[model samples]
Target chain A: MSIHNVIQVEGLTKKFGDFTAVNAISFKVEKGEIFGFLGANGAGKTTAMKMLIGISIPSSGKATVAGFDVFTHAESIKKSIGYMSQKFALYDDLTVKENITFFGGIYGLSRKRIRQKSAVLIEELGLEKVANKLVGALPLGWKQKLSFSVSMIHDPKIVFLDEPTGGVDPITRRQFWEMIYKAANQGITVFVTTHYMDEAEYCDRVSIMVNGKIEALDTPKKLKEQFKVANMNDVFLKLARG
Target chain B: MSICVANISKSYKNVKALQDISFNVKVGELFGIIGPDGAGKTTLFRILTTLLFADNGRATVSGWDVVSDYKNIRKSVGYMPGRFSLYQDLTVEENLQFFATIFGTTIEENYDLIKDIYVQIEPFKDRRAGKLSGGMKQKLALCCALIHKPKVLFLDEPTTGVDPVSRKEFWEMLKRLQQKNITILVSTPYMDEAALCDRIALIQDGKILEIDTPEAIVKHYPKPIYNVSANNMYKLINSLNAYQYIHSVYPFGEFVHYTDKRAEFNAVELKLYLESKNLSNIRIEKTVATIEDTFMELAK
Candidate 1:
């Protein structure tokens, strides 16, 4: 594997009984690249992501995340990467400060380091006034932003975001993307999945999965040209519909 | 009017969910409530559908009071909540039959109303609702919601988390449903979908920001927008934001949508400034305002 490639996969397949959830998908993600993983609903995006994140075992495949083999070093892979999903990320009952500190501890940071990190995180996010409030009381946009920050508290080499800006307001959604750009500029690879096509355009490269396999993978401009469409949304509609 | 809401307000504990919300939907009109999550959209929908009560003000559906005449409203309107609310254990066909029976109607009685949508999911009629795919489940839910042939339909974020293709198909189905003379009121966070509605209400922070046709809303933008692009997106955004004449900078697809604080701005001067910052391959062009632009301006 190349030193710059943070994630390398070859013939990665996951099967359940008679069904193949992810079929022989292969791709490489370079360091600090924003990779967009897109597919229709029930196209095995979640399953493929699960295998890559080291939470699920691939039935038959060769994959490495952060230089750790998925089959042999699953635990190491989990520790080397950060993950946040729209459905579940942070504990709602916990306060913002507590949530940040808890995630820091989970990532095995010392108590002193956790304190320093939490202070910086609170100030950076401008959450000084609401740091003591329960996360459940915060607005949806604030919760999403806090969740992203908490996921990165460990400063992993790569972060996986699943629909991070699903229902956020227009401005907050843009703000969230700006945060992503900052992370990428700091040399952290971002593997993200989103339903919004405009957000898809923000990625450096995008791979569209259909049925259990990746049918097309390229930059937004190339994909648009290859499909003879005007935008990513049209390309997606043509591919997914077919 | 098919639906009327006057000064509706609701609160939960210390959080104000809805405040002084008012709107009216004409008969056979395809109206939309466009907002993001926790914007009091669900609260207003529940009150109008008679599933929940407002702490103040009043509402009516089909000219009947939502409180005193809830039973009539319930029978005359179809509601599909944001989440998949069908019985998971039951087959798709069985769920539809059950909903039809509860409404004191038969599938044959209202077959024409949901024929277009139901046919798409008929292949999975024997499958349990829980086992269906996301798109199939959405179709099944819509089918059940229309089995009774109500005069009005209330869909609360029906396409939330759905893919772009399915979202387009769902909107087409709604347009066809409108031809049958049913007043449709749907809510979604997608600004693009707002254009499909005859009129839309943009809501945020439990308050109605604006209510007008999507075209009119875009025209309300006070400044001319420009599509600005450079080789590096991140640096371009930062440099634009740091510019003295920058009014607003938001990243659109493949470009940054920028507006100037000055009434008469020169694009050439801005291009030269970016060039000084070591940016190359710069492009700037005037672009029309979209619903999202209007929404952000209003919300701000």
Candidate 2:
């Protein structure tokens, strides 16, 4: 892995009213690494992601995404990163090709460039035959893959996936992780948050958020060894319980 | 049988929601209906709960026919739909009272049955159901469902979208309920949760793949599998997939779960091959099967 850090945060915090959704947390993510951010629902995982993605302003802290300050260069950070939220950002009514074209247009890609990228993407995912099929008509697995590929259509420096594999069958989930691996292989830093502890095992490193504070951060193997647990799920259970 | 389903089938237009599905739950057993979305879990739940009818076959819940004895079934069974169906505008306390009154009983009459689950949410009694957190809302829903002291409870995806901590607590609540001899039939898409059930019916495309204890199902895994990982997981998986002798390759946790067609596979030889491919930090070990592994094998 490269020593270059794509993301850096120190004493980051966010508060709403009296509740601190994210406490003073500090961490750094290296370029070309898969970083897994974990927490239970309402554990500030979403809040932290929003702050890092530059959508939500942090109450206090220092952070940067892709060498751009999250506070001042939020707009530049937005342009330099791609985000795939839990609720898919695809237009279900649109055909596969149409969805790609629309997202490409949103990213300001030229018509010719969009066409080129769409062709390569369709061929890569074996969606050549269903390129014109409505996204709603495709199976859950196909739609997930299509949504992920669309997120990378712009080839940003980093990609953030929030619960990308929820509700997908085991087979489809495996296939989706393969896509994540390929993206990381191509040197795109992957920042992902998931409820599925098993997915944590695939990351180069992970940080577990509890309440509003980052309780644990390390390689998955080390975290498991430190907690003296058989798997990531037990590690999470122990942390969440505490 | 606390619940019995025999040759149940249902269809909506051209789509078959359920097909010849059958299962039984003994009194006090925690039965699980496991499947993904569109797997007909909701339809089956609706049928048993008397909210919908099956086009064919028969079912009985709590010794009452779902069709002929709908009224009795409704009285003896508590049903919690997949989605949060309680009144969003009502306060937590008000929702519980409304359910209790509709069942012709006061909360005081069955307070003991719901006390363990309800006490946690009692502090939020004034909070609107919509304003409560996902976990708190689930607890209130469960409280209202059990307010009438129903003999059987049906919870559809109770833990979906809940945090890991809340999910664990909810399952503990289910176990506590089982002590009162309340036959619980729960459904979830999460394969790990299947292990918590006494017996689970794995469903896919509206068909039952297997019905057995989680342990027995894992014991039946057809192949000896290996957990394999290397510095570059992407390359490791690709190499495994391209290997002629490999039968199946899927990502499992931090490693790739591998199966080979050969009777006797050599882990060292495979390691040497991966080494030649310039893959470092390789780790391979025999691993026991899990519900997810069994589910994938059966799904294929």
Candidate 3:
């Protein structure tokens, strides 16, 4: 892990109307580390991601993503980071290559650069066969890979993935992680949220969110050890039950 | 009565869903139809419940042929679809009663069958199904499905969008439900859940990849699995994958789940190969493969 943090979140609080969606949570993602943001459904994981990505504002406290303030420097932070939500981010009706071009353009890439990046991204994701195919026609696994590749269109310093492999099969998920690993190898820090316990174990470190708070954070091995459990599932069970 | 499906094949417009899929569920058994999304599980479930007809072949649940005895099958089986299609405007209790009434039964008649699950959400009985949480909705749906006292139960990805704790609770409820002699045919994409079933059929791309008891499936795995990790973890995984003897390698947690070309290969030799590749801090250990591992092997 790098000494300098890519993401520094402290006492972060987010509220919607009257409900406190995320309560005073704190954590830091070191540059170049695949940081696992772990939580169950409605555990406020998505809410926290939205705040860190600058889509939703924090109710109080401070959060800087990719060395830019999430509140004041939102646009600059957005430029330095990539994000893939739990829901499909690509338009279903667009061709695979078209989705890539669209996202690249939205990120302010020049047409020439978008074309060049599109080719590299498509080739890396093995989407050459389906470049012209509608994203809806591609398998869920393939679309997830394409979505992840699209997130890094501008070669951002950080990427946020929200359950990137929700419904993908084991083989496809295994392959998806290969792409994540490829990105992490290139010094791109990954901030991903997932309910999948096994996927948590793949991260360099993980933070378990429950009821709008981060209850646990550590490497998967250490979390297992601290909980005296056999796997990440047991660790999650312990934290969730509490 | 046993449930049997023979040569079942169905397709939507221009897409073949099930292609000659065959399987059977023993009486009082908890059977699982395991597969990724769009692997024809829903179609098969619909065929067995007599809602949709197969383009070819036959299926019977509890001694009633789905085609010839459609009404009887509908009366005798419970189905929780992949998507929650319950009347959103209806209260939880209303939904339960509606399903029971449709099957020509009453909640009082089968109250004992669903008491445990129903009681969990009793306070919200007057709440609209759409207003309930994902876990509560699942509970209410299950109660409705069981209200008719069906001899068989078919749940399509019952734990799909729920929390982990609720998923565990749901599976526990199924175990208790099995005590009442109801055979279950459940479909799930999560391989970890596969072990809970009495038997599982691994499906992929509209084909039956494999079907057996979870234990049997794990025992049948042909490769000697090694989970190895090292510094420069990404490079280690890539290097191990690029090894001459590496048959199939995929990332599994902190380590790469690798199987060599030779069954007789040793972990020590594999470790040396990593060293030869100039990888440092390499730690390799032999590990027993889980259902997820077996599924990856089958699918790949």
Q: Write the per-residue lDDT of candidate 2 for residues A197-241, one digit (tens) a residue.
A: 889999999999999999999999999999999999999999998
lDDT of 3 by residue, B150-212 (tens): 899999999986767888999999999999999999999888889999999999888998999
Q: Which portions of model 1 miss their true places by more than 4 Å? A: none
Residue A172 in model 1: lDDT: 93
User: Residue-wise lDDT of candidate 1 within B155-239, one digit each (tens)?
Assistant: 9999999999999999999999999999999999999999999999999989999999999999999999999999999999999
Interface Cα root-mean-square deviation for all models: 0.6, 1.1, 1.4
**Order by DockQ, highest first:** 1, 2, 3
At residue A69, candidate 3 shows an lDDT of 89
Candidate 3 clash pair list: none
lDDT of 2 by residue, B154-227 (tens): 99999876767889999999999999999999999889999999999999888999999999999999999999
Top lDDT model: 1
Residue pairs with backbone overlap in model 1 = none
In model 1 chain A, the worst 10-residue window by lDDT is: A136-145
Q: Show model 3 residue runs off by greater than 4 Å.
A: A1-3
Query: What DockQ values do the models have?
Result: 0.87, 0.70, 0.67
Per-model TM-score versus the true fold: 0.99, 0.96, 0.96
